[model samples]
Every structure is written in C-alpha cells, then in structure tokens.
Target chain A: MSASDDIWILGISMTKFGKHADRDVVDLGAEAITAALADAGITMNDVGVFAAGNLMGSAGIAQQLQKQIGQTGIPAYNVSNACATGATALRTAIMAVKAGETDIGLACGVEKLAGAGLLGAGGQEKSVGHEWTPSGRYGAVGPIDGRIGTEAMPGVFAQIGMEYLHDHQYGGTAFELFARISEKNHSHSTLNPLAAYSKAMPLEQIMNDIMIAYPNTRPMCSANCDGASAAVVVSGEKLRTLSLEQQRRAVKVSASILTSDPFEQACQVLPNINTLTRNAAEQAYEQAGVGPDDLDLVELHDCFATAELVHYDNLMLCEEGGAVDFFESGAPWRDGRMPVNVSGGLQSKGHPVSATGIANIWEVCQHVRGEGGPRQIEGAKVGLAHVIGLGSACGVHILEKSGLAA
Target chain B: MSTATTIPFVDYLVLEPEPHLIAHECTGCGARYFDRRNACAGCFATEFRDVDVASDGIVRSFTIVTFAAPGVEVPFVAALVDCDGTSVRGNIVNCPPDPEHVTLGMAVRLTTVAVGADDNGVQAVNYGFEPR
Candidate 1:
C-alpha cells in the first residue's frame, strides 16, 4: 500500500459531551488522551507527536498536556481553526504518519465553555469582532455583527432556514422540517450513552419550545458545553506488527481533506449553504475513491437543525432542495439507508466547539469497527465524518474497516 | 448647553444624513468589497477604485434576532439585502421585526441611524437597510 493508504486509526475516545463544571479544559483533554492511549494498548512513551486543538484557551496547551501525561520531548502542535480545530489536529497526525514522520501520532480536541466567561450572559459574545471583517485573513461573515446589532447564531441560521424554505419546494412546512430534523437527532441521542441529552423529545415539544429566533426554538440549537475527544493513528506497517486482536479492530484512514472558503464579497446574501463544505466533501470522496452511495453512515456538523438540512444537499448526499424528502424517506435514521448523526450530532450530542469534530470521528470509528452498541448501523464498514468552522474551514474524513480493502 | 456631535460607527459608513455605503471595486473583475482591499481576490489586480453602492435593494434573506449581546435590543430584523448587483448584510429597520412585516423580496433603502452616544455627547452613526 502507498504511504497515504497506510495510515490507520488505532484507537479513539471522548468524554461525555456536556457542561463539566468540575473539570478544566486540560483535565478533559488529558482524560480523553489517556483513554485513547489505553484503548490503543500503548502509553505516552510510544506517541511520537501530539497535536492538540483548542479555540478559547491560552497557547502551550499541547505542552501543558505533555507535562501532565509525562513529557516525552516529542514535538507538539497547538492547532486552532475555530470549530474545525479537532479535525485539523487529526489531519496533522494523518499527515505525519502519511509522510513517514512518525510511527504513532495522537490528535486531541478539548473545549470548556461553561463558566469560562466566553459567552458572557445575554449571549453577546456571539458578535463578530472587527478583526474578522472582510479585511481580515479569515474573511468570512459571522452569525452576528456588533455594528449591525446583535443577531445571535440562532437568528443567523433562522434566516437561512426561511430563505431555503421559500426558495425550495418541499412537501412540508420549513418549521415542520426543522422540527423533524431536531426530533430525529434527539431520538438518535437516546441510544448514545455519551450524549448530553439521551431522552427522545416529541416533535411537538421541539416545535413549541422557547423561540430563541424566529422559526428556530431553543431545541433547534446546539448547546454550549465542555468536553474533549482524542484519537491515535499509526502507520500501516505498525498496524501489521500489532496483535491480531488489534489488527482486527483497526480502522483505515482512507481520506482526510480540509478546505477553506474563497474570498467572497457577498457570502451571506448568496444562499446560506456552505460552499467550503461542498468543496471539502468533493475532495474527500475523490481521495477515498468512494462516492456518497458507497458510505454506510455519516457524522456531520449539525450546529443547528437547519444546518443538517442544508448539509444534506451540500454534501451531495441528495439533490439540491431534496433534503426535506431525504429526511422524510427515513433515510437519515439509525436503521435507514445512509444513516446520519447516529451520535445525535451537535444538536443533542452537545457542541463543545473544538471537541465536536473529534467526537464525530470517534463515533465513525466505532461504527467502522462494529462497536457502536445500540446505535450501530449493522454491517457498517465505511463511514464519513465532516465538520465546518465559521472562520470558515471544512474538514472531511473517510474511514473503512481495516482489511476490508487492499 | 450640550451640542450634539456625530461620528461614524465604522470607517466605511459615510456620515451624511442621507448616507450611502461605499465599496472598493476591483478594476480588473468589477468585484466590490465593503472594506479596503489590498488586492483583488477575483482577478488578482492591484488596482481598485472606491465606488458608491446603490442604496436600494431587495431582501434576499432575513431573520428576527431575539437574543443578542448586552445593550442591543432583542427582536431586530437582521437581513442580507441585494443592492444593485452586490449583496450587503445589515439590519432591516423602520419595520417590526416579525414574519408579517419582514418578508422576502421586500424593497429596502440604505440609510444611516444613530447607534449610541459617547460620554462627550458624540452620537455614533451606523448604516442599515430600511423599508423603502
């Protein structure tokens, strides 16, 4: 196998994604990293590099983690790419292994938002700073702009939902479809032990919930929490040297692609769907030599109910304006064809920003290894994980059961 | 006696009572940007010219924001307006921020309003798209 094809994910682990008032970001990160190491049947001594992701933390986080896990004098990188930090870190590890730079590499993502003074009361922190304006390096429109008055995240997505509904011909009302998406994810969360909300919410309750924004109630939005997730990747040669049991459980990293948005003058006004996500997903599918039809499941960034609906089309899983039908066909359910977000996604799984991307990978790895207990897609062999950040970066990774190909 | 002073909220907003937004237009590709551009992203041209964006446009998408940062009032319409051939993001004012009042394709005109006043009695001015 080529070096690119030789990269394999040996283990994955994540903390229960929710408001961990008692834990620091570092503690959450260490717990996940330690769990991942144990799952890989290895120790920190065996890890050649550590790539850590955090958005609202100080620098030297990777070094801090290294100190806690016993400093091995290995090079550690601290990655920050808004919400896609985890996936960016994971891609760094994949590159390291693909380039023969390391036999074993670790990628980790951690975030602590609760009581971090990040969101401040009234959700005013949602406003975009002047530095993020069109003149900035990460030039992309934000959910809220201070000069334009505080339009929070829910409001931003609500606009997209309304426009999408008006522009498309759907069998159901936009509100109903949004509620359905929320209800579906909540139902899927019931089976995920690590999910923050495991109880199935009725469609009525979701629709009737307190409206944070027009057409978007509180239930339609992802919760801000504290959590971490980590994964260990190794070269294919290293995988072959492992025990038969380990080899049997290994998952191959078929593709890891990341893309950023091109400079656009009118990003928000031009259909709220993410162009970067489509670009990244296309590259990932090509790199993996697999199409959307061949995948067993997907774990996408569902930051809001409308986001999930928009992504169904952006990922090319269905035709444009066909997401409502796709959901109505029961295709996105756990047992349905091409199940999505069996982990409840960010909606019910809890979105701790940086941790979210790694959490998606953890869920996909579980499915690929046939380890997803009640939520498993039976006979699942191939899966996709996708995440997008607002500073506007998108990451897509495809994984297949080891020994299934090549 | 206190005298009222006015200042632009952002450098891009022209402070005339009947104000209009300005954009940096690329000489090569005609791509317009709200902020100053060092280079054109469309045609990679180093030359640009300041152009006045048309004040009238239709609402492409809108939302009523009920939650916001401190000091900003709730239930305001945040909209993306298509002005002439370019798209601009701003708040839709002079109308109730609700589904009944803020509909798609609503015609809006660009106008300036006071955002806040400093301790020195200087009124900070910001621009928005109002019902035409």
Candidate 2:
C-alpha cells in the first residue's frame, strides 16, 4: 500500500535482551522509553499515543508500564498477533500518522517472559477452537500440535530442503551454506550488546553441534529471550524541523505490507517467491520512489538460516535458487550490493517474540543514523525489514534516511 | 486416541461429540478450511457444509527433540502432516519411526493418542500421528 510521506522514524531503543532476573518487565520498558526519548531528543509530552505491542505480557500490563515510567496520561493500547506483536504496534503507529491523529507517537513493545518462567511459546497456549466435524475414515490430514516438535518441524524444512535438494541435486552445501549463514549471524551477535547469544562459534563447530531438528542444529533455532524495546516515530514534516543532524538520522517507513500466503500463488509462488518478496519491495520502492537496486542494507527474518536463502529468492535480491550463487560469491555482505543482518538477526540476536520486529526496525534506524558503531554499513542510505508471522502472515517495511542526518 | 466418542479438555470442559476437524469446500470462492470458520479468511463464504476429514495424512515435515525437561520424555518426534491438500502438526507416534523411512512426502494416518496423564494411572488421550 501507499505509505504517507508525513510519518518518519525519529529514534528507537531496546533493552539488552536476556534474562534479567533483577528487572521487572515495567522496569525494562521504562529504561527503553527513557533511552528512546533521549535518543530522539524528545520527551514524554511529545508522545501523543502510547501504542504497545506486547504478546505474552499480562492484561493491564500497559497500565503498569506507564505507571512505572511516571504516569503519562496518553492513551495506551495493547496489541498482540502472536510473535508479530511488535510489528503490529509499529503498523498502528504508521496508521495513526497517516490518519492525521498525532504528529508524534510512541510505539513500544516489551515482554517480561524470561523471569515469568515460560520456556517454549504455546506449550501453555490457549487452544482456540478450529471448527470441524469428524469427516471420513482415518486416512486424512491430522490436527494441529500433531505436526510440531522434533521430527515434525524439522521434517517440514528437511522435506522442503530435500525437495529443493532433489530438484537441484544440492544437499551438502545447502546445509553447509545454511550453517555458514547461521555462524555468521552468531558471530555478528557479539557486536550487538543486546543480543542474547553473543559467543560465536566456527562453522566447523556449528556443523558438529547437536541437531535440534533434522538438517538443523540447535544453534539454528532462535533463542527464547525476554526484553523490551521502544521507538519514537514522528511525521516527516516534524522531523525536518529538528536539528539538521537529527533530520539526517530520521528513517522513513516507505511501504509496509502484510499479506497471507494464497495457494494459487503457490504454483507461481515457490518458483517465483523472489517475485513475491520483490513484489512487496517494489511497492515500497514505488511508494518511497526507491528501488531494490537502491537498498543499501536489509534485516530479513533469519529465524532459520535456510529461510534467509528462501528470502533472497523471495526478496528478488537474486533469481530463485540463485541464493547459492550469492553465498559462494560472498555478495550481500557489508561491502556487497546489499548487506543483510548488520545487527545479527533472530538467529543470533535471540528472538524475543514481541520485541523482535520492533528490534529489527530499531537496527535499521541505527544503521541509517550511523549509531551501529562497529558493524555499521558505510554510506547506508536505505534499509528494509521483513518478518513472517505464523498463521502464514508476512509484513515487509522499507525505511530510508530521515531528515535528520549529518 | 480414545474411542470414547466425547472429547474433553483438562477433565473439566467436555466438548460433546468432540469437534472433529472438517473442511468447508467453498463453491463460491473455491477455498477450503480445516474445522469450520465463520467465513473463509480467504473468501468470505457465510454458507459452508462440513466435510469430514480422513484421519490419514503424509508427514510433510518432522523434527526429533532431544531436550528432556525434568519430568518430560525425550527422543519423541513432532511433525506436520499433509492430507486432503492441507497440512497440520501433531506429535508423531506408533511404530518406532525410523528417521530414514520418514520421507517428507511419506504417508501416514491420524491417531488420537492420550497425551497427558488421566484419573487412573491412564494417560489423557488426544489427537496425534502414527505410521500409516
């Protein structure tokens, strides 16, 4: 869809993710909000709406967060869409800007899951009803939870990989290339002080590590994390009024699209997922009047390393099945045409459910603002962020240098 | 899987006759959904008839978990099965499934096995997967 030219991302902040037994969830949020306000050189009074993306946080949690942060009378609404909670909040903020609600709004996502003692997501999840009547004999499709866990989840990836393998006759490298990709992210995590798994291992070690799912090792699985993150988004017109350096640091959200997988698109979809990813990219490019060839860096969801390869095809960074070619050529790096995951990724940064999508935007914001100290991609002009939520939903957003830059 | 005919949750909520998974074949939109939906999320069809599902499916994706919690079992498999042109996930059980014979497109049937513990020393049964 068309994004309004008025809304721009001014500043973003996130608490270092990991189990902080000492800090309460509200405390974590308070810390991030303070950091965000300071980062944007703004105060709570500038925030018109308190939009919170909290998936697992208890009810009335936003009230508690605001109380802890010293009572902002702004309206706070809680948003949840499983793991995509944060992005949903971001979406709301963008919608608010487009609707002429407020010039500046706060989009914050925080979850205090670590100390809450929940390990895996959905183990204790409330089972929403799926409408059905027992159909024919015992020869049909199974139900949910039947196809999860050990052999099941891996079975899906391995099957898809094996199919790809059978089709391309490429196996060993698929796993190896994926491992290298995972290892690179893991290594990149060390640079991110907020990332959970900072200690990186060699590809040899990752290859030898205990397998979690077939063709996937434990390292490939995103770590369960607990953290809080916040961002201050303002209208582009307002951002231009800020200091020249601040304007240079502002990142503009171009096109943000959320779509589900349509089966008819499957035939053409898998073969041309690159087209699909590029389809969204093209929309963002068109809305922002930028092109895929213009993006300097990206933060594609690397929940699993293999996903990134699929994404390369989907994002139209290369032709379908040409990810292998890009990997071997060492392109899409810091110096490559498009640097990816300059802030590590869910693979290495630790996927904190609600905070992940917002954290991704936070990373892109830092990259364009030149705050990513060591891992910074020089001359980074535009950034793209994409995340796929379950229920087969996907959202992609594009951001370019805001008005406040050096 | 219990032959009990009634599906219950937590020994408290009794889902009478147990909601069996049925798909709605939309003539208007040509979209199908497992279990009934108010309207196809894809196609808003208010009219839908229940098509009883076959309990069999091909294991599309599978995983083996070795992480054993304090009171939990390990080496169990979780998988996604495709049958009737759709996929769903559940724990894979029955014949000691060899990871090798398990192909992505391997065929299997749905087995409703007791998962958690029950009133007696018996385990509470629900739906899962077993080798076809």
Docking class of 2: incorrect
Worst 10 residues of 1 chain A by lDDT: A131-140
- Give the proportion of true interface contacts each model preserves, from 0 to 1: 0.41, 0.22
Position B50, candidate 1: lDDT: 82
Model 1 lDDT per residue over B1-132, tens place: 446476566555666655887777899888987666678866689899988888999887777777656655677778778899888888888898777788887899988767645556666667788898
Candidate maximizing lDDT: 1
Estimate, for each residue in A1-406, the C-alpha lDDT of model 2 and write its tens digit.
Answer: 1234567777789889888888766777788888888888898878877778676667766677778775668778788765567777777777776766777878777876653422332222232343222232322222222223432333334334434443454545455777887877887787888888788779988889877555567677666677888888887767767888667767777777665555541221121223345566666667777766788888887766656766776776776667777766766655577778867787778777777778888888777776778888887778888876554456678877754455
lDDT of 2 by residue, B1-132 (tens): 444433322221122455334555665675655444566555566777655555678765555555423333556666656666655555677756445655555678765555443333333345666777
TM-score of each: 0.90, 0.78
Clashes of each: 1, 52
RMSD values for the candidates in order, in angstroms, are 4.3, 6.4
